[model samples]
Target: MRMLAVVALLNLVLVASEAITLEPCALALELTFWRMSGYLGYTLADWLCIVHHVSDFSIQPPLSKTAEKAYGIFGFSNKYWCSDGVQPSRNYCNISCEKFLDDDIQDDVLCARRVLTRNEGAQTWPQWAEKCRGKDLSSYLKDCKL
Candidate 1:
Protein backbone atom coordinates (compact mmCIF):
# COMPACT_ATOMS: atom_id res chain seq x y z
CA MET A 1 0.00 0.00 0.00
CA ARG A 2 2.81 2.44 0.79
CA MET A 3 4.53 1.65 -2.50
CA LEU A 4 1.32 2.34 -4.41
CA ALA A 5 0.88 5.64 -2.66
CA VAL A 6 4.47 6.63 -3.50
CA VAL A 7 3.94 5.79 -7.19
CA ALA A 8 0.75 7.84 -7.28
CA LEU A 9 2.51 10.79 -5.69
CA LEU A 10 5.30 10.57 -8.25
CA ASN A 11 2.79 10.56 -11.06
CA LEU A 12 1.07 13.61 -9.59
CA VAL A 13 4.37 15.48 -9.41
CA LEU A 14 5.20 14.64 -13.01
CA VAL A 15 1.81 15.86 -14.18
CA ALA A 16 2.18 19.10 -12.28
CA SER A 17 5.60 19.79 -13.79
CA GLU A 18 4.30 19.20 -17.30
CA ALA A 19 1.36 21.53 -16.67
CA ILE A 20 3.70 24.31 -15.55
CA THR A 21 6.11 23.92 -18.44
CA LEU A 22 3.60 23.40 -21.24
CA GLU A 23 1.22 26.27 -20.71
CA PRO A 24 -1.11 26.72 -23.71
CA CYS A 25 -0.52 29.63 -26.08
CA ALA A 26 -4.23 30.50 -25.91
CA LEU A 27 -3.62 32.21 -22.56
CA ALA A 28 -1.94 35.17 -24.34
CA LEU A 29 -4.21 38.22 -24.29
CA GLU A 30 -4.36 41.21 -26.60
CA LEU A 31 -4.13 43.49 -23.58
CA THR A 32 -0.78 41.95 -22.77
CA PHE A 33 0.48 42.85 -26.23
CA TRP A 34 -0.61 46.44 -25.76
CA ARG A 35 1.19 46.59 -22.44
CA MET A 36 4.31 45.21 -24.05
CA SER A 37 4.10 47.89 -26.70
CA GLY A 38 3.99 50.53 -24.00
CA TYR A 39 7.06 49.03 -22.42
CA LEU A 40 8.88 49.00 -25.76
CA GLY A 41 7.97 52.62 -26.47
CA TYR A 42 6.03 51.77 -29.59
CA THR A 43 2.50 52.56 -30.72
CA LEU A 44 0.11 49.71 -30.05
CA ALA A 45 -0.97 49.21 -33.65
CA ASP A 46 2.56 49.13 -35.02
CA TRP A 47 3.82 46.78 -32.32
CA LEU A 48 0.82 44.54 -32.78
CA CYS A 49 1.43 44.33 -36.49
CA ILE A 50 5.06 43.44 -35.97
CA VAL A 51 4.37 40.76 -33.40
CA HIS A 52 1.51 39.37 -35.48
CA HIS A 53 3.82 38.75 -38.40
CA VAL A 54 6.81 37.61 -36.35
CA SER A 55 5.47 34.96 -34.02
CA ASP A 56 1.71 35.49 -34.12
CA PHE A 57 2.10 36.33 -30.43
CA SER A 58 3.32 32.90 -29.47
CA ILE A 59 5.39 32.75 -26.27
CA GLN A 60 7.44 29.90 -27.62
CA PRO A 61 7.23 29.77 -31.35
CA PRO A 62 8.78 26.63 -32.78
CA LEU A 63 12.44 27.00 -33.74
CA SER A 64 13.16 26.24 -37.38
CA LYS A 65 16.07 26.39 -39.86
CA THR A 66 18.29 26.28 -36.78
CA ALA A 67 17.04 25.66 -33.31
CA GLU A 68 18.24 28.00 -30.53
CA LYS A 69 18.89 30.84 -32.96
CA ALA A 70 15.70 32.88 -33.12
CA TYR A 71 13.49 32.80 -30.06
CA GLY A 72 10.53 34.17 -28.10
CA ILE A 73 7.49 36.13 -29.32
CA PHE A 74 9.60 38.74 -31.11
CA GLY A 75 11.96 36.16 -32.60
CA PHE A 76 15.18 37.72 -31.24
CA SER A 77 18.23 36.34 -32.94
CA ASN A 78 20.69 34.42 -30.78
CA LYS A 79 23.55 35.62 -32.90
CA TYR A 80 23.08 39.20 -31.80
CA TRP A 81 20.55 39.59 -29.00
CA CYS A 82 20.68 36.61 -26.70
CA SER A 83 22.93 33.63 -26.23
CA ASP A 84 21.96 30.11 -27.18
CA GLY A 85 24.20 27.40 -25.81
CA VAL A 86 24.84 26.09 -29.32
CA GLN A 87 25.88 29.34 -30.97
CA PRO A 88 28.46 32.12 -31.05
CA SER A 89 26.66 35.24 -29.82
CA ARG A 90 27.30 38.86 -29.11
CA ASN A 91 24.93 38.34 -26.15
CA TYR A 92 23.87 41.96 -26.20
CA CYS A 93 20.93 41.22 -23.94
CA ASN A 94 23.17 39.28 -21.52
CA ILE A 95 20.42 36.70 -21.27
CA SER A 96 20.04 33.07 -22.16
CA CYS A 97 17.85 32.39 -25.16
CA GLU A 98 15.84 29.85 -23.17
CA LYS A 99 14.52 32.67 -21.00
CA PHE A 100 12.83 34.18 -24.04
CA LEU A 101 10.84 30.99 -24.66
CA ASP A 102 8.94 31.25 -21.42
CA ASP A 103 5.70 33.21 -20.88
CA ASP A 104 7.36 36.03 -18.94
CA ILE A 105 8.34 38.75 -21.44
CA GLN A 106 10.05 41.47 -19.41
CA ASP A 107 13.49 40.31 -20.48
CA ASP A 108 12.42 39.98 -24.10
CA VAL A 109 11.08 43.54 -24.02
CA LEU A 110 14.34 44.89 -22.66
CA CYS A 111 16.33 43.03 -25.30
CA ALA A 112 14.02 44.25 -28.04
CA ARG A 113 14.59 47.80 -26.89
CA ARG A 114 18.31 47.32 -27.26
CA VAL A 115 17.80 45.89 -30.72
CA LEU A 116 15.77 48.90 -31.77
CA THR A 117 18.33 51.33 -30.38
CA ARG A 118 21.19 49.56 -32.11
CA ASN A 119 19.43 49.11 -35.42
CA GLU A 120 16.98 51.14 -37.51
CA GLY A 121 14.12 51.35 -35.02
CA ALA A 122 11.34 48.99 -36.13
CA GLN A 123 13.12 48.18 -39.33
CA THR A 124 15.50 46.04 -37.25
CA TRP A 125 13.03 43.31 -37.95
CA PRO A 126 12.87 42.47 -41.65
CA GLN A 127 9.41 41.08 -41.17
CA TRP A 128 8.28 44.51 -40.05
CA ALA A 129 9.71 46.07 -43.20
CA GLU A 130 8.12 43.43 -45.41
CA LYS A 131 4.77 43.17 -43.65
CA CYS A 132 4.12 46.28 -41.56
CA ARG A 133 6.00 49.26 -43.00
CA GLY A 134 3.97 52.16 -44.41
CA LYS A 135 0.73 50.23 -44.69
CA ASP A 136 -2.64 50.59 -43.02
CA LEU A 137 -1.91 49.68 -39.38
CA SER A 138 -4.81 51.25 -37.52
CA SER A 139 -6.73 48.06 -38.09
CA TYR A 140 -4.43 46.27 -35.72
CA LEU A 141 -5.80 48.25 -32.80
CA LYS A 142 -9.33 48.77 -34.11
CA ASP A 143 -12.12 48.31 -31.59
CA CYS A 144 -9.68 47.89 -28.73
CA LYS A 145 -10.86 49.89 -25.71
CA LEU A 146 -7.34 51.38 -25.33
Candidate 2:
Protein backbone atom coordinates (compact mmCIF):
# COMPACT_ATOMS: atom_id res chain seq x y z
CA MET A 1 0.00 0.00 0.00
CA ARG A 2 2.85 2.42 0.80
CA MET A 3 4.56 1.59 -2.46
CA LEU A 4 1.33 2.26 -4.34
CA ALA A 5 0.97 5.71 -2.71
CA VAL A 6 4.53 6.62 -3.49
CA VAL A 7 4.18 5.68 -7.11
CA ALA A 8 0.98 7.67 -7.42
CA LEU A 9 2.53 10.75 -5.85
CA LEU A 10 5.51 10.53 -8.17
CA ASN A 11 3.26 10.20 -11.16
CA LEU A 12 1.24 13.22 -10.12
CA VAL A 13 4.35 15.32 -9.63
CA LEU A 14 5.73 14.28 -12.98
CA VAL A 15 2.48 15.09 -14.74
CA ALA A 16 2.23 18.51 -13.14
CA SER A 17 5.76 19.43 -14.04
CA GLU A 18 5.25 18.26 -17.57
CA ALA A 19 2.12 20.31 -17.95
CA ILE A 20 3.71 23.50 -16.67
CA THR A 21 6.73 23.37 -18.95
CA LEU A 22 5.08 22.55 -22.24
CA GLU A 23 2.34 25.08 -23.00
CA PRO A 24 4.06 28.19 -21.77
CA CYS A 25 7.16 27.62 -23.90
CA ALA A 26 5.03 27.07 -26.97
CA LEU A 27 3.18 30.30 -26.26
CA ALA A 28 6.44 32.06 -25.70
CA LEU A 29 7.82 30.88 -29.04
CA GLU A 30 4.83 32.24 -30.93
CA LEU A 31 5.17 35.55 -29.18
CA THR A 32 8.88 35.67 -29.93
CA PHE A 33 8.43 35.10 -33.66
CA TRP A 34 5.92 37.91 -34.08
CA ARG A 35 7.93 40.25 -31.93
CA MET A 36 11.01 39.49 -34.01
CA SER A 37 9.14 39.98 -37.25
CA GLY A 38 7.72 43.27 -36.00
CA TYR A 39 11.18 44.44 -35.02
CA LEU A 40 12.45 43.67 -38.48
CA GLY A 41 9.66 45.74 -39.93
CA TYR A 42 10.40 48.58 -37.57
CA THR A 43 14.11 48.55 -38.40
CA LEU A 44 13.30 48.99 -42.03
CA ALA A 45 11.13 51.92 -41.08
CA ASP A 46 14.06 53.62 -39.38
CA TRP A 47 16.32 52.96 -42.35
CA LEU A 48 13.71 54.47 -44.63
CA CYS A 49 13.55 57.63 -42.59
CA ILE A 50 17.32 57.95 -42.64
CA VAL A 51 17.57 57.48 -46.38
CA HIS A 52 14.76 59.94 -47.03
CA HIS A 53 16.16 62.51 -44.60
CA VAL A 54 12.98 62.56 -42.56
CA SER A 55 13.31 64.53 -39.36
CA ASP A 56 14.70 62.34 -36.62
CA PHE A 57 12.04 63.67 -34.28
CA SER A 58 9.20 62.38 -36.48
CA ILE A 59 10.83 59.07 -37.40
CA GLN A 60 10.80 55.91 -35.29
CA PRO A 61 12.00 52.38 -36.11
CA PRO A 62 11.65 48.93 -34.54
CA LEU A 63 15.30 48.45 -33.63
CA SER A 64 15.70 45.01 -35.13
CA LYS A 65 19.36 44.63 -34.26
CA THR A 66 18.63 45.47 -30.69
CA ALA A 67 15.90 42.88 -30.60
CA GLU A 68 18.19 40.22 -32.05
CA LYS A 69 20.82 41.10 -29.51
CA ALA A 70 18.24 40.96 -26.77
CA TYR A 71 17.47 37.44 -27.88
CA GLY A 72 21.06 36.82 -26.89
CA ILE A 73 20.90 38.72 -23.59
CA PHE A 74 17.76 37.60 -21.75
CA GLY A 75 15.97 34.24 -22.49
CA PHE A 76 12.72 34.66 -24.30
CA SER A 77 14.69 37.83 -24.16
CA ASN A 78 17.67 35.52 -24.88
CA LYS A 79 16.85 31.84 -25.20
CA TYR A 80 14.81 30.03 -27.78
CA TRP A 81 12.94 27.16 -26.09
CA CYS A 82 13.04 23.69 -27.59
CA SER A 83 11.16 20.78 -26.05
CA ASP A 84 12.20 17.19 -26.82
CA GLY A 85 11.02 13.67 -25.83
CA VAL A 86 8.34 13.20 -28.48
CA GLN A 87 6.73 16.57 -27.92
CA PRO A 88 5.02 18.57 -30.63
CA SER A 89 6.74 21.83 -29.74
CA ARG A 90 10.17 20.30 -30.21
CA ASN A 91 9.34 18.94 -33.63
CA TYR A 92 7.60 22.15 -34.50
CA CYS A 93 10.53 24.29 -33.44
CA ASN A 94 12.95 22.37 -35.65
CA ILE A 95 10.66 22.52 -38.63
CA SER A 96 9.80 26.15 -38.00
CA CYS A 97 13.41 27.26 -37.68
CA GLU A 98 14.24 25.56 -40.96
CA LYS A 99 11.33 27.24 -42.72
CA PHE A 100 12.19 30.62 -41.26
CA LEU A 101 15.75 30.30 -42.47
CA ASP A 102 14.75 29.06 -45.89
CA ASP A 103 11.76 31.24 -46.72
CA ASP A 104 10.37 33.80 -44.26
CA ILE A 105 13.59 35.66 -43.61
CA GLN A 106 14.24 36.05 -47.30
CA ASP A 107 10.75 37.34 -47.96
CA ASP A 108 10.89 39.75 -45.02
CA VAL A 109 14.30 41.04 -45.99
CA LEU A 110 13.08 41.73 -49.49
CA CYS A 111 10.03 43.50 -48.14
CA ALA A 112 12.18 45.50 -45.78
CA ARG A 113 14.43 46.52 -48.65
CA ARG A 114 11.46 47.72 -50.65
CA VAL A 115 10.00 49.63 -47.74
CA LEU A 116 13.28 51.31 -47.01
CA THR A 117 13.63 52.46 -50.61
CA ARG A 118 10.22 54.15 -50.56
CA ASN A 119 9.88 57.67 -49.17
CA GLU A 120 6.51 56.78 -47.68
CA GLY A 121 6.76 55.96 -43.99
CA ALA A 122 6.17 52.56 -42.39
CA GLN A 123 3.55 51.71 -39.79
CA THR A 124 4.28 51.94 -36.11
CA TRP A 125 4.71 48.69 -34.16
CA PRO A 126 1.14 48.66 -32.92
CA GLN A 127 -0.06 48.84 -36.47
CA TRP A 128 2.38 46.20 -37.63
CA ALA A 129 1.44 43.90 -34.75
CA GLU A 130 -2.19 44.24 -35.67
CA LYS A 131 -1.43 43.22 -39.23
CA CYS A 132 0.79 40.35 -38.09
CA ARG A 133 -1.89 38.88 -35.86
CA GLY A 134 -3.88 37.61 -38.80
CA LYS A 135 -1.02 36.50 -41.01
CA ASP A 136 0.29 32.99 -40.38
CA LEU A 137 3.97 32.09 -40.03
CA SER A 138 3.78 28.56 -41.33
CA SER A 139 2.92 26.10 -38.50
CA TYR A 140 4.85 27.11 -35.41
CA LEU A 141 4.56 30.88 -35.45
CA LYS A 142 1.01 31.47 -34.31
CA ASP A 143 -0.44 34.89 -33.49
CA CYS A 144 -1.94 34.83 -30.02
CA LYS A 145 -3.58 38.25 -30.29
CA LEU A 146 -7.00 37.07 -31.36
Q: TM-scores of the models, in the given order? A: 0.71, 0.20
Per-residue lDDT over 49-128 for candidate 1, one digit per residue giving the tens place of the 0 to 100 score: 77788777666534477644678877888888888777889898899988887767678778877888888888898988
Local distance difference test scores for all models = 0.70, 0.31
Task: Please give, for residues 1-146, the per-residue lDDT of candidate 2 as tens digits.
Answer: 99999999999978544311123234334334545334534432332222223212121221345422111001111122222222234221222222222212333333333433442334422333343334443333233332
Give lDDT for model 1. Answer: 0.70
Q: Cα RMSDs of all predictions?
A: 5.0, 17.3
Per-residue lDDT for 53 in model 1? 81
State which candidate has the highest TM-score: 1
Pick the lDDT winner.
Answer: 1
Task: Report the alpha-carbon TM-score of model 1 versus the true structure.
Answer: 0.71
- Number of backbone-clashing residue pairs for each candidate, in the order shown: 0, 5
